[model samples]
Target: MNEVFDYVVIGAGSAGCVLAGRLSEDGQHQVCVLEAGGTDATPLVQCPAGLAAMSKATHLNWAMQTVPQAGLNGRCGYQPRGKVLGGSSSVNAMIYLRGQPQDYDGWAAQGNPGWAWADVKPWFLKAEHNERGADAWHGQGGPLNVADLQQPNSLSQDFVEAGVQAGFARNTDFNGGSQEGVGLYQVTQKNGERWSAAKAYLTPHWGRRNLQVRTGAQVLRIVLTTTKAGLRATGVEYVRGGVRHTVHARREVLLSAGALLSPQILMLSGIGPAAHLREVGVQPVHDLPGVGHNLHDHLDALLVADAPQLTQSFGWSATGLMHMVQGAWEWHSKRTGRLTTNFAEAGAFLKSSPEVSRPDLQLHFVVAKLIDHGRQTVWGHGFSCHVCVLRPQSRGTVRLRSADPLTLPLIDPNFLAVEDDLQRTVRGVQMARRILAQAALARHGAQELPHSACAQTPGEIAQWVRQTADTIYHPVGTCRMGHGAMDVVDSQLRVHRVLGLRVVDASIFPSIPSGNTNAPTIMVAEKAACMVLSHAEKTSVAAD
Candidate 1:
């Protein structure tokens, strides 16, 4: 028999780390964090731009690919998930955005009570220590370190000006009072290094008595036992390295393995779509029909251009690989210069339609521009703007290929499946084109890339959105939380058919937040930690 834990957090991604850190602070509960991959001890995992290099490292990533998306000209889209300690936060762009207030209210309307913008606002303020100091909306005393780039790129300025010229309101801060505007992004960084979940939450408490962090430990399934009353999650069975072991949870099993894997683990433990579970050779423990139904991801394709001067555009190097190496050296020795910037420094949030109350599209401007898959960089110089429709109307599903816990689940985001998702994407492209056409960018000879759809008819633009759009890497709502019968989790984020199990990641989001999801994800964890701690305290009082 393996050891038992009070709390077994499945994945040590953004949410798991926070949960583990906060839950163990009381010195009473023993928290075991099961990460499928190893520790985030890589050299690049700390560098801001290391995300691009790390993206190609499949060994450190689960690296799941989607089924051929009809929306992207039948291309099987790529979805890279961090398999290591800090999870995707370790590998993501590190851009810190909380989305808009309306995004939360929309959740409340969908039946996730106590989760409106105002309700969750405190968590955002409570978890941040921004370089800009405290404000009405931002925090000053928080675990996470957020800051602006020391050297704002000139390309970022032009991109903002272009958007303004295109009639976008230039609001500098999205996380502030309003979000409809253009500006440079604040990132999850310290000094200039990446502030991954480990750096922010876990590392500070590594040697704590109650926190047991296990890397390279794959949790096979949640084990349950039953009394006369109902079912209870008693523990978890996991495998580490090559050895199979079982670790029991005496209190609760928290699944923070992110959107893709969390739902998969649920089904493997027999808590998903009934028919689907039986087909995959798992007896249905619960008939939660919405375990993996609401699959959505923001799609953005590169709009490349030749730059005026020598920008960091990885787009132009038959020979600049040396520069990248030298730059990495400079960053490692002293965290400054080119390596400090998280490429795509500039960004904006815009409403695709005035009728829509919240912003539907997001864009980020990158300094380096090149042609052809970032391989054939134009030597002269170039820039690219990535635009994504934040709220996708189309939904998809994630189903298990088999019952094996070791295998990756089959994921289909169904990108652009809904007409509005496609329509908004087309609008996003139009808005971007308008930005590029501005006189500011015109000074830089902003020639649009070949792939940018030049179609005048909205129908043609929509078709291009379907054909060329790609995931901007924000996927959510698989184990959807809401009021409908198909909803898997309720307002408190508890699974409909299970007791003592909660999903506290981006996966629990009913829809993708209207901006970058990293900061909002942390907020969810903060809220979840409070909810969990309160329950644990209540359970303790009862025992007394």
Candidate 2:
């Protein structure tokens, strides 16, 4: 017998966790959350510092690679997405940033009505439980905990000081009045442990009788039924433990599988462009041409410097190894120590040029030398700074490689496809170089690594950027929200022509934000939860 539910949410990711917790709150609706990966109960997930290792752990990370990009000298970039209960949140750097207000305003301007800064601010406030207490710009009592780092490396403070020395103001809160300065980043952590979306929303409601969470249940496709009204998503087919299970959704099916997988699921369910579906051997159910279009991400370039004299910095050495062992014990005992660090402890948002209206570039100053997203091992004490274009003109697609749901989708971010993107990135690199050269960092004996020091001229810098730049892991807009010819979902996050289905993750973002995307994604889920419940309430009234 097939199980039934009022809502079936695919992917127990950042958005899905929120949906599951909210939808089942009234204890009236049975909501089922399906996750492709297993548990997030291990120390690797709970510890904030585990992010370095998690990036390489295939069991926890999707570690998806993009198609060879012509722009980055035909190099395929690394894309690490979390596969466990919290999704990317379980394995991310945990920086809690909501981006600039104008970002959502831009979404509103692009025909997504309720996505303006004013419209979405309430959701952000509603979802946050900030450690610094409540104010006009923040909330005090909510599920997701946002707190300052318990123990940040001294180098991180030096980075912030260096930014101030480089002419940028020091901002205590990036999510506050302005996002245009440098400071220590507030993280999604509580008492030094990672406060992922799953930990915040789902874990607290684990005992809720109406909510069911299924791990290691990979959804194959949505089961759509054609009725007189339209094609409505009724259920889903999933594989678990070598057995297939069918579960019916009485009211709706919510796809929160994230930017990369949401559109993949839709296409596998035969709801993408007609021609592409046919080519992939999937029978077309809906001829939505925009299902997998408008893909873009923040392309980041790194500047590394060897800081062997800085004993506080993390690296491989007898002293560093001993510190790690001691820090682990300290974390295990009191949830405080160097192990509490998120690595990317400090960052800034700056304008690539003074003429720009808003900050168009972002920086992440890591306490350790991060080469290849921490996949490559570099033995020594050093620091790395990341500069990414806040917005790129380039766009790409997420298309089906095969009709099989298990097959990875063809991801083409087409980074640096536009010459303007490369130029902006070059400018960002120059600015970062200036910041690093500041007396604040220079006093700590920080010296530029060979790769960065070798690139001096404009031509050399641009060439170097093309040769080394890759994604900083913020991908969005594959199932973009808008009211245009290429839009996949409406302002309400409903699939353009589908019934009883919605995409409520970063995938629905009309455009990428100016900073990290996790906070914005949580806010999206908070707002989407209200929409889903409101519609259900009205439906119940009409039925009565």
Q: Each model's TM-score, in the order given?
A: 0.95, 0.99
The 10 consecutive residues of candidate 2 with the worst lDDT sum are 444-453
lDDT, candidate 1, 166-199, per-residue tens: 7888877778888888888888889878898878
Count of residue pairs whose backbone atoms collide, per candidate: 6, 0
Per-residue lDDT of model 2, residues 444-487, tens digit only: 88788888689999899999988888999899999999988889
lDDT of each: 0.81, 0.93
Model 1 CA deviation exceeding 4 Å by range: 316-322, 370-380, 453-457
As a whole number from 0 to 100, the lDDT of residue 258 in candidate 1 is 85
Candidate 1 least-lDDT 10 residues:
370-379
Model 2 C-alpha lDDT versus the unseen true structure: 0.93
Q: How much does candidate 2 score in TM-score?
A: 0.99
